[model samples]
Target chain A: MPSLFFTRLRQGQRTLPFPDAGPDLPERFRGLPIIDQSLCPSGCDACVEACPTDAIASDDSLAIDLGRCLFCSECSNACPQGAIQFSRQYQLAASRRADLVLKTGQSLQLAHRLADDLHRILGRSLKLRQVSAGGCNGCEADINVLNTVVFDLGRFGIQFVASPRHADGLLVTGPVTRNMSLALEKTYAAVPHPKIVIAVGACAIAGGPFREHPEVLNGAGAILAVDLFIPGCPPHPITILDGLLRLIGKIASPAAAHGEAP
Target chain B: MTISLPSFHNGEPISLASVPLLSIREFREEIIAAAGAGATLTALFGTPAESGRVRLFSVLGDPVAGGLAALSAEVDDAYPCLTVECPQAHWFEREIAEQWRIEPQGHPWLKPIRFQAPYRPPGRTWARLPGVTDFFAVRGPEVHEVAVGPVHAGIIEPGHFRFQCHGERVFHLEISLGYQHRGIEPALVGGPGKRTIHMIETLSGDTSIGHATAYCEAMEGLGGVAVPARAQALRAVALELERLANHTGDLAALAGDVGYLPTAAYCGRIRGDFLNLTAAICGSRFGRGMVRPGGVLFDVDPRLAADLTRRLDNALKDLEDAGRLMWDAPSVQARFQDTGAITAETCAALGLVGPAARACGVERDIRQDFPSGFFRFAQIPISRWSTGDVFARAWVRWLEIQRSGVFVREQLASLPHGAIQTPVGAPRPDHLVVVLTEGWRGAIAHVAITDPNGRFARYKVIDPSFRNWIGLAIAMREQQISDFPLCNKSFNLSYCGHDL
Candidate 1:
């Protein structure tokens, strides 16, 4: 009887740390897009299109928005440069939409400049909301992972408010598959005035790979007012963290990722 | 990949029998005839021709004909409809109907599961595709449609399940998917590269090894490449760990679903323990580090291997004690018994695999019948039973767990030392290599294309859920509404895995 009691005691003690540490969150646990920009091949846009979320962007160079990425890692795997990765930092969960917006890696200079430009244009504090255009769920999956225990993004003083009506910015993921226009339009229209749109993944920038689909209507920037552009297939979590940091001036410049030519 | 001439696949001319469907009207008839014959092929899913025509595929088990093979008929919208007689085919047919506009003519329950009504040219939105006839119009009394997802309240993947009937007893259910269709089929058609494994590994997070192992086997089979014996032993070890981890977690989940918190908590805690062990050897915990195209990517750490065996032996004893408590408790047994009962007939008709079908008395496991990788070695054992119910599922998974321990021991003792993987420079072009793995769930198949140099051309991954989701819809019939969590848990179909 004493031994059984001890066994039970041992079992209970083990579970003590419980969910405070968060979920098992598994390996390749697709959290958010974190780009090691140093590894990216500049002109290749496979990840941009691979993201069901338009969480990737590359008008000139690639950038990412933590707020919109799905963390599908389609880009990381598809990337010839091995520039993207899925980080284990899932607990960026937040209630507000904009609190999650983060730019990652050496690309922060562009993001900082873009954020300054947005602040100048708005002349006030800003908030952003994200909508997916024909992206695969990679970006969305990561974005959702952020809402879990580890990242608890709400602590970052940002929130992922569902509606765009009260937003200062808009984030987009995916290549704008033909089927998503109405939902995108509805989401876009729901946002209030003085909004700046940030295209997140590769798809929104140039329609990514699914560009010539007979059904798709590409170019998210064409649909709204543009601000900053972040690119990745599905960037990594740190990239997302970096992207948000860049927006709020927490980080001076976009950081370089691990294992790069630098 | 060798293309054998169309000999006789279940006594039918395989590829030559199909004709290009000209319109949607004719296609409806086909569904009607097949449905009447008790043919309930869930998804008419396959690759579309680059020339812009769709291949209409259906899985059938004809008593007169015999066996299950995906019967493909490439056609335009004018193919026949199978949904007319098969009322359960509303969602899949609708997806096919909207994506290709190949309507199932006589579908009794024509409803907009995904695509919105009043079809649009490019008006097809994400959740709302172009269009399918609205299903909400036919509402049963006392029960209203509760549209659950595409975006869920939990961290689970997106799948829209519509319940039909009054509040208490569910008369019927319709599951709508295709939300995360990342164009995996199209991506597979290009050169083979890392994407194949990436896509396969992520096919279902839990089913990773199953898919990857099967994929490596298929590619090797096609290329006729011999794997190093040491790598084979390591693959066996990895597979056992994966099975052990998945089964332990699943048993706990099943317990939790029935509201047994202790069992739930116990199993959940150990779930990651095995994954951590896997990481101790491989860089990634998902076992993604090894098992490449030709062979495994790396060797296991000998020290790590020794540690794993000890850890596993200890876990086995703890698990056994827990199982005793679970089986003896009346409340737990009450919660489990007949909660999710799938008949043997239903399983055979649907062709469900793994524990889901095994529990129902369907004695089919790819490891034994469709052998690959380390499975051919006489060292490992295959555990099975033919119950075909939730209890049966639990039984099979438990047996597998026990068997897993034995396999791990064998693997460690017989650990071979040698080079792990051969160099894969580039792929041979213009050939089709089909790879299949017996994932914890069941058969995981990967279709890879290599160009002349051995780099990827195109790769298609078909996880068991692609076939098993059909069993879920059928199994739910006559089950009480409250038991859905139990029923769904028994099958545990990976929504993200299938959506991709």
Candidate 2:
């Protein structure tokens, strides 16, 4: 017992003050990307060819879909003209699916607030049940981290419950394989009415790299009506927390949270 | 007598024609004899053959000789089962029967393993849904069956577990899993295209670096590409980091299961710190996009290497404290000490790999047995404990965490200087290449066979989970039902890796 107390004292405080202070991400941490269109020469398809998931499309301009991107930064490595660079902004979640697609020179915008009814109901507290359909456990690991001491997602009253009945929403991960499809649907149906479904990670949003596989049903979007889409191969814990906070109208905006001019 | 099966070293490719094909009787005898002579079956599967016959391939790893022997035979429909003689062949024979529609006649317990449709051209399909197979029953008035999950209570992959319990004691536990199958092996048949590496990366997402390195090593062997020393060193560093992170997380999880909160919370945070160190080098926390075919995609410069060394040291300190707390706590020790013990004899018979096998006092590790890449130079001592219980498993992980930390620090201090990557040409036609990587989970085996057109014809990935899941089931027998979570976490088998 003394040892436990001493260990706790030694660990100290590790949680980050997120809304008041921005996250201190690593130097090589690939977050939101910035694409410079003028740098690309005519018919330069190196980035497109380099992408493993076809996240980059080179039509009139280069557009990257975060839902499909693994944030591997292979596109940046393959870009000969210095066209694409990943910025250190960890705020990349969005309320709508289409908003996740970013064209060249477009800055990442904050996710919109939830509906008035949702805000009134779940603004103070939100309970979620995570279902990993065909998840590789990467996303599941990150979701589990949200409950750890550092993140302490419960501090904001966002807790992952054991049963669907206690959850106000469902946090779905993985690329929803055929065998898990029925189980995922049953869990979704078990949630009470007016429940929100938030898709976390690239696999949950756009099937990530397994999009074309015959076994998977693309992602959760194929089965359920998704209210929020958090993107990353497995989105950083900060990204997931930001997405959840935005969905419940806990935080005003990403720009406001970071103290930047909108 | 020695079997006339063609043999090759790790990461060395052999021509498909060079593998001698024996008759059904000879093939069965050779495998049984080889197992009797201390060789273990690494892989056994069937590929489509001409004239509607299925060609079976068997790989036996001779650890003492440090070589792998490959043999094949053409079977029309049914063949004699080797599991009757060599118990390790049980799961492999059942899998071959399911995928090829061939019967391993006279096998004791045969059932659909994954419940997925067979590969095309033969086009056999099972109409039954996943986890719909008949289970082994314990019949008595006191015996009752408790079925749990295709959907579990925890945030984890889906798999069904059926336990026949007598009062509070479990008589037998049957695991039926196919919920996470994504047809990954079949998807790799055509070519090593753009999606191939990505597919390998997500084969078992947590073991991304392990699978990706194995696949790359197999491809490099087939293409005759030499990876730079620097890239090999970097790959080893990433692999060890993966091992460290996972072991730390698992120890914490075990602590959590036993209601030891301080270590659980601290270890969880420390695990993230190690993952963040990986992200400092590459982009993803899982080490994705860092390992490519010819060499690694990212280079760790001196500055970044120093940063990693510092962060790793800090994380290791934290982990040490957390581990000490858990081990020192009598409550944690009591819960973990005697729970879910599997004998070394059972471990060997089931062909269990990784920490689970090591915890049983079986010194079987790919890095030591078949050293390839950087492991060929820098060696890590095999971490083992003989108790074969939850405590032994946790202790083995703690030992590995310290050893891997020392290894990563040493490698980072002497960061090699060279190009990070080289171009890999087309693979050799009609060649078979086997690559074994000691992933965080255990020995991850990737066997790639190329067609005449230099494309992947039959790509087999044997995740350590494939060899270790049965160990978990065996460990649960006659144990308390409430200890299932502790035992399951001790094995920590991957559902999708096995289902695939």
Considering every candidate listed, which one attains the maximal lDDT? 2
Q: How accurately is candidate 1 docked according to DockQ? A: 0.10
lDDT of 1 by residue, A42-147 (tens): 6778878775545578776576654445344557767877777766654332222343344444312235534455446543344556666555444544454344
The residue ranges of model 1 lying beyond 4 angstroms of the native Cα positions read A1-7, A15-262, B1-76, B81-133, B136-141, B378-387, B424-430, B448-459
Please list the residue runs of candidate 2 whose C-alpha ends up more than 4 Å from where it truly belongs after superposition.
Answer: A254-262, B121-125
TM-score of each: 0.66, 0.97
Q: What would the per-residue lDDT of candidate 2 be over residues B101-123, giving only the tens digit for each residue?
A: 88899999888888777764456
Tens digits of per-residue lDDT for model 2, A8-31: 888889998887788878777888
Per-residue accuracy of model 1 over B72-96 as CA lDDT, tens digit each: 4566554445544454454456556
